[model samples]
Target: MAEELRLFAGVDAGASRTALVLGDATGRILSRVRGGPGILRPGRAGAVAERIAGLLKQALGASGPVASLEALVIGAAGAGREAERGALEEELRRRVESRAVLVTTDAAVALQSAFPEGPGIVLSAGTGSIAIGRNREGTVYRVGGWGRQFGDEGSAYSLARAGLAAVAKAEDGRGPKTLLTARMLEAAGKVSVEELIAWARLARPQRVAALAPVVCRAAAEDPVASLLVQAAAAELAHHVEALRERLSDFAIPVALSGGLLVKGSAVRDALVARLKAAEPPVNLVDRGVDPASGALALALGLRP
Candidate 1:
């Protein structure tokens, strides 16, 4: 009998959710499973590591022991640093018996997810925004993804933040009056600016990002909202351009990934328009890019 087809696994461990896929050595995907958040917080590596193993067991349908897995590759946020990767890897090793386990950044897997073995840049705009690229030399470069408090420009968090600021400015007479005050309040389901403030103080990043669509929709009729949207696009464009500068002297393919780059998106359209105007412009990939597949590629030893 042919040596039983070896099994490999891949996981895309995102902040809000995690995606897991199992496949044979031939790369024929066998199972797909989704689970809770897989964020690799500073001190919570063990918990997240447990979640990863759980994902594997689930993908295995509770039939085979994890030792049967030939290898596993996972990409996650907070795993860019050596210490973070080490911590998670150490914890995962204790719980898993796979022949090999690889830990990498969500950005790295995203670039692989988009370009695979080729060299390209991936711009991700979601609850947070970041741009990562790989060049011919296999040297990986990154531009943004600093998180909300520091950077994360062009992210939904940033857009929502700017919207809230606009509301405050308009309300305080510090800036031009606009529809944001009314719309933001409505989106937050609060009757007054005061109530919105109360909600904001306790709200999480995802909740704050939830307000971005309201601002995006209001952009059509509100100058302030419009400016916010333009600035967001400009920020995202800057992310791509900055990566382009470091990746190569010549143009490189740029792939747009993340939840925010949906079809007909104002931010997506505006960013595309701006990049298209650049000298040599940006060559974009029209198809969807999936980071889970990228992780699977790594697991299969298919990535360069």
Candidate 2:
């Protein structure tokens, strides 16, 4: 008898959006869908799960009753830890019938996408930031997965925070002024700085991060903003270098993902330049494939 063919599903879920891709045993894409955020924030878990379930069904689109799904692999924003992973796994199990299901931190899947054998560094800097790397020996090292307030270094949130700092410095006359201040002011449409502060105090951290592009654009012409962008790129490089040292794998590839590194990206070029200038030039991959591909890769492995 011929061997049975299997189907796989992959999901890459972030704070701002989610992507799902279905692939056959041969790693060919069958269906793909993109939707709103998938992370279950403090009070939004139920809603997020609902959305994910909806997207899955919508993507499947009556593809002859998807019960044949062999395996599922998901990379989600908060799925790194046991608590969040457990919740997500249960939710997925409830929604679909699969032979096996795996839920991993978004960084894990991102790294997998970058390095199929799982030995390299991946920096995901969309609404937040995380640096994860696997050594040639299969050891993993992670840095800066803390949320926005605590860390998230070199993230959109970090850039936006830097923008706020620039705005403050400009207002206090303590540093170089920037067009970022005006752009931010325009974003808020606040009459005064005080109102801007008040508005931000009541806003979500991701909401703050939404303004990162404004800062990046301003950086093109504003010295302060430019400094911020360069600084962030340098910081990201530092994290990559640190992972390189810890893993002692100079040849390890580094992959960059996330919205900030994608369309209208301002720091991708600078980041690649800094990596190439490292002690031993780090190999940088900029294929820009969605992390969901990694999940699909994992899922396909689960089949017969």
Candidate 3:
């Protein structure tokens, strides 16, 4: 009889999408699946769970016998809360016979991925924004995970909000004029600023966030848009500065990630420049590893 292969499953559940990857002990990917957003948000648990189950099945098909699985690691948005993490863990255990399950907030995996072996800061700007890091001596620092309504100061939502506001103010002659009015109008496909307001007011977080790229593209040719991008980058750097103060005693590498940074747009360059402006500048280190890989490392108990 052949021995049953023990596989590790890594899951990253976000507000917009959920990713699942099954891997061997040697970090070889066996199967990967993606599904609708996780049920971390309020009042969407049932639908989210159903979506996640479908994705899990797809991943399991390629992973072989789920009964022989050794460990599962899940990094999810809003999973930082103890109750939330506990609930998801219970659900997973009931669904499968995996020997162990580890659940953490997505930021945890991002941090681990950025600095698997040591101390480093990770700036993630997606639908929202957060800066997280751990020092060599085990001290941790964090900034800006307040969500879209309250914070998300350096996130895509922030950019969209600023762009819309600029156009609105310009239309009313209350702010400086800019080409962004035309650009935003084109991107939103609306007749006027009023229509744009209505369009974004009812749109999902990611939907509003989608305009960030458009904003960046216009910023390249428009000075007003450039100022908005610069401001967003500055805000992100401010968070890094706060972390720096908190970890004053430790030497740490700083990594910029997510759509804004990865895209290499003006916003990202401004963020880098602002960080360097600090009195004691941080070292910009490479976060070569992706979040999915970090989740895998966590599943296999190989994370540093």
**What do the candidate models score in CA lDDT, each in turn?**
0.84, 0.79, 0.78
Give the per-residue lDDT digits (tens) of candidate 1, residues 184-298. 8888899988789779879987788888888888888999999999999999999888888888744788889876677777788889999999877888877567788888889
Report the lDDT tens digits of candidate 3 across residue range 1-304.
Answer: 1333667778777767788888877777888888877736554444544565677678887665465567878787766577777777777777756778777877778887778766788888877888888877787777888778788898988998898888889999999899888888888889888999888889987888888887888888888888889999989988888887787743578888777777468788888888777777768876574676678888888432
Error of 3 at 89 (Å): 2.1
Clashing pairs in 2: none
Better model by TM-score: candidate 1 vs candidate 2: 1
Going through the candidates in the order shown, the clash numbers are 0, 0, 0
Show the colliding residue pairs in model 1: none
lDDT, candidate 2, at 54:
79
Using TM-score, rank the candidates from best to worst.
Answer: 1, 3, 2
Candidate 1 lowest-lDDT run of ten? 61-70
State residue 11's C-alpha deviation in candidate 2, in Å.
0.8
Q: Candidate 3 regions off by >4 Å? A: 1-4, 302-304
